[model samples]
Target chain A: MSNRSHATQERILAAAETLILGRGFSSTGIDEIVDAAAITKSGFFYHYADKNEMARALVKRYLEKDNQVFTDLFARADSLSEDPLQQLLIFLHLFAETMTRMEMTHPGCLVVTFTYERYQADEQVADMVRQGVLTWRQLIAQRLATIAEIYPPRLEVDLEELADMFTTVVEGGILLTRVFDHNKHLGRQVLLYRNFLRMIFSPDPSR
Target chain B: MSNRSHATQERILAAAETLILGRGFSSTGIDEIVDAAAITKSGFFYHYADKNEMARALVKRYLEKDNQVFTDLFARADSLSEDPLQQLLIFLHLFAETMTRMEMTHPGCLVVTFTYERYQADEQVADMVRQGVLTWRQLIAQRLATIAEIYPPRLEVDLEELADMFTTVVEGGILLTRVFDHNKHLGRQVLLYRNFLRMIFSPDPSR
Candidate 1:
């Protein structure tokens, strides 16, 4: 009985994620999610008191899965690529690959969509999104610092600032992609970023 | 009669702009805008067909004003300081001053808020925003090229790429400022940008 109940809850969550990503947070209703999941209203309310509660559960679950993928990608540093700059490049490629797969096969970033939709409506959810963003930025910053350490005299750039820039570019790129329905622009952005990376890693005469 | 009619329309536009900047596009409703402007529903529709139409008018007005400012900023080339790098610094300072004033005096960019809100919701408005962004990037690229003419060959980074980066940073900074309700982060971003300008304008070491 418990196994069947758990399965039903998972189905509902999966359906909610898809619906929210496609139609956005505010527009997607509880009725749509339950219908997609093949569940009754009573079953849905039994699991979640309201749509907000369901969204809270969805965000947490989505973040857990997303973080796992990020952790795995950043792991195995010693196994391949001795050069930190090359490792960073590999990470970028992997990041793009992961995003392409998820967006094409599943849906978009729930946190980004939710943040845009619900940030002003609900303070508690907004705080969660803000903290999540900070945590993600810190992760990128730490990796950038590690990569910067591989260079002679380290780097002239502030790793934290660079990380923020990187995060912004990726997020901004995703936004542009959604607006235009193309990944070609993001490819150009990546190339521009590569040049920026080269500018930093190369020997500086001004230094 | 026309003067009174014009004044009423202007008042409605101004009130909507202020409200949208402070609270975001989605959260601000027609009722609130009417309330804020002290206008009737009939009067509101007299000026704008709908909220979207009002936003379009606001965007057009903003772009006109922005174009005038840009022209003035770049007009005095010969009379100003001879140093290209110094000129760039002064430009950044002037731009920062205007941005700070906007935030302090009124809400931040109306176009920016509109872009984030309506980018996904409406296509025509999104195109307007995309063009607005592109035009700003192109203008900055022209400025960077002007600076590059005063420097050595290798010191000249891709002007378009650099301009795009500048736009990205400013947009990201403003978004962060809105989220955190602070300008310190924006200050840090501008400082970093100034440093980048210095790095680019400096002589090439490999030469």
Candidate 2:
């Protein structure tokens, strides 16, 4: 694709994501996306064959962008501290800060939206969601494993479930934030998770 | 309404909930709901003027059923223990057990589903969702306030945010459970939240 064509596709995907996030995939139509992207129907058909194809492409792009964000944030966190626990804590602090900085309510997650409306999604989209969730589990559990090697947890901890807690809190926080129309809920939940980590791994309970 | 008419309305609501939970409010048509309920299109119209009206009714019923469940569970916990902290702990334990007993992947929450598909919902539906979330927050926060009075948390905690954590964990857990096609994730998350409560409120670090 030429530079202009690629830019059009990007605009289309971005518009589609916003619409889908707000109204869900089944309710969002091709005409609306084309209108929002300021492109013709032919321009959309030039990129994605159908809505399902668009959904697949959209999900792939979303996961890639999400993965990149995590990689960049954790790299920044790791650069600041050598200790695995500190790195995890710094990463969460940075994350909460990011949420706090958001100018708009965090848009809902596609994986979550798709999961609830799974009957409308194709098997390929469903498989991608499952993989995306596992990827999050792997990313956080690996960090927790390293932390566990050094500072034996005060309580018996299932590192995988504990790792899943980060994703859980954020997912839940976003839902609450959207429902309440408040932006602070997500950041507060992230900080609460941070406190949970401290109580579990810190030698001094007072900390 | 006559007894038969009430039973038919109940059938329509139950069928609508299942279809909407699976396919979302915008995608699940009245035709489909009437078909699922084994009623005529006119029958559906007799009970609900339109899909929006059905949605309002569905949300109202869901919130009430949810409130009753929590009330019964906490009451059971209270009857079992005089200590507020123990009652909170027992309540969480009971909540986890309920998730574990689910024969199917827990059907997703309507409040969450509607929140994501808010563009398709009316203002009344949106207000109900906001109120439902606040109810959950109030129920759990009241319990936490009682616990904090007795034990004095080791960490300086925001009781409201902490109460929201229970809803957060359960909401997130349900999403993860659906995405992963696993029954155990929700129960595990509830148990983890229970552990976090123990860590926060218990006087002895080792407990």
Candidate 3:
């Protein structure tokens, strides 16, 4: 695609994302997205064969961007600390700070929005969402296994379940902050998860 | 007013909920709801003045049922254990079991579905959602405080934020389980949470 066409497609996806956040994929029509993007009908169809195609493209873009953020943050944390547990702690703390600095209360995630509705319009959208979550689960679970090898928790904890907790806290924290209309608790929840980790790993409880 | 009207009303709400689970409120029309209920338009109007009224009724019914479940489970836990912390652990264990026993991956929650889309359709719907989350937050926080009084954490933990974690894990766990097309993790997430509580409260790290 040419630079102009790429930009138009970007604009169209952006518009759809914004509307989908406020409503849902089914309620949001292609015409509204085209109008919002200042593109003609033919221009919209040129990029996406249909809304289902758009859903696929949007999830792909969102996951790529999300994975990049996680990779960068984890890599930076790893550089700062030799201990896997400490690295996770630092990563979560930094992650919370990033969310706290957001201008809005984390304008809902596309993966979450689509998953909650479980939209029948696109099976591919749901597949991508499941894939995105599993990717996060895998990412967090790998670090947790490293931590468990070095310092096993007093309680028998499942490494995979522990990993899913990170995803849970984030998605759940986003809901709480959004519903309560505060950007505050997403980071707080991350810290709480961090605290749980520290309690499990740190040698001393009172410390 | 009559039994027949009450049954019809329930049928309509149930239909609306079923549809909304698969989509959003805006995408679910009253006509469709009445059609699903096999009720005439006049019968639908008699029960609900408008879609706004239906939204209100749906939320009211949903919250009452949700709260009752919490109350009953907590009561059972309290009866089973004298210790507050033990009671919470038991309640969470039972809750997880309840979720695990679900025939299918837990259906999508209304509050979560609506909150994700950040629906612009009704302010009242949003308010009810916010209220429902707060109710759960308050419910969990009260139990956590009881646990804290007897067993404070090693780290400085915020009770309110900790309470929200229950809500977060649950809502998040449901999403994970649903997205993965498995009804497995919701309960496991609860157990992981229980382990976190155990780690925090027990004096010995190696215990």
The model with the greatest TM-score is 2
Q: What lDDT score is found at residue B184 in candidate 3?
A: 81
Better of 1 and 3 by DockQ: 3
What lDDT tens digits, residue by residue, belong to model 2 across residues A145-201? 988889999899899889999989988888787777667888899999998898788
Candidate 2 backbone collisions, by pair:
none
Tens digit per residue, CA lDDT, model 1, A70-127: 7777664334587777666666666666776665577456665655566677676677
Best by lDDT: 2
Off by over 4 Å in 1: A1-23, A29-46, A76-78, A82-86, A100-108, A147-156, A179-181, A187-191, A201-207, B75-89, B104-109, B145-159, B204-207
TM-score of chain A as modeled in candidate 3: 0.93
Residue-level lDDT tens digits of model 3 in B1-207: 489878887898889888877666766777888898888888888888888888778877888887898889889999998988888888989888876775164376777777766456688888888888888888888888877888877568777877888889988887787687677888889888887776666566465
Off by over 4 Å in 2: A103-106, B103-106
lDDT, residue A203, model 3: 68
**Candidate achieving higher TM-score, 1 or 2:** 2
| Candidate 2, residue B143: lDDT | 84
Task: Summarize candidate 3's per-residue lDDT along A19-43 as a digit string, tens digits.
Answer: 8776777768888988998988888
Model 1 lDDT tens row, B131-194: 7777777877876787788874344356765776666666656655555666655555666676
Model 2 Cα shift for residue A122 (angstroms) = 1.2
Q: After superposition, how far is residue A119 of candidate 2 from its true place, in Å?
A: 5.4
